[model samples]
Target: MFNGEISASSLQQISPVSFAYIGDAVYELYIRTNFLLPSKKISDYHHKVVEKVRAESQASYLQNLYPLLTEIELNWVRRGRNSVNKSPRRLPLQTYQQATGLETLLGYLYICDRPRLEYLLSQIKIY
Candidate 1:
């Protein structure tokens, strides 16, 4: 979890760029944890799951899954997606970054001992 508190004033002072930085790692960890299921072969599973966890796939997942998120979670996703100063990659457009942010925020929440992450994952009808 991010212990660094962002006050209202400080929120304005901070940059989306910075959030994205944290968000990227957070998202990847979530994917790695979630996709590393016991049922799948390691190499084949990694190949299959990596596509879903990547920037483009995550963006698509976010779009399809957005309606299920609660208000607070949605806000976090939006903040991450809308953030500026993102590093460009060979993936799709801006949506990938946003997806990364959402994943990262979810990862952060999970690590912070938030029960909502599990709840949210459960509500996601689409795998």
Candidate 2:
């Protein structure tokens, strides 16, 4: 959905929060697409995302991704991590923020370049 409209350089104009918003959708879609079981219940699908999208969980994903991310991606993650966003309910503040940062990086890579995004996705060790 993000391949043709905006270039990666121009995406810099987008706020980190905005990136996270889109990133949330992108990652959710990816998770859904990756686990395409026709018999799965909606609750089961949501639980899967809940397991992965939580602050601590996403932070772990970011931790694992550190070695694979490029300098630019790392910069984006730092910026997203440092962004002044709201605290998510029931989650630790820093962890939620870090998750947002991870989401932002995911979103940025997604819109900036799909092939690069796919490459990054390939490196993720999903369970």
lDDT of 2: 0.81
Residues 1-127, candidate 2, lDDT per residue (tens digit)? 3444786577768998888888888887887777667668888888887776667888888888899888999998988988855686787778887788889998887777778888877777768
Model 2 regions more than 4 Å off: 1-9
> What are the per-residue Cα lDDT tens digits for candidate 1 across 19-120?
556545655566567766667778876786677666667676677767777676677677766664454677555766666666655654554435666665
State each model's CA lDDT, in order: 0.61, 0.81
Q: How does candidate 1 fare on TM-score?
A: 0.61
Pick out the ten consecutive residues of candidate 1 with the lowest summed lDDT: 104-113
**Which one is best on lDDT?**
2
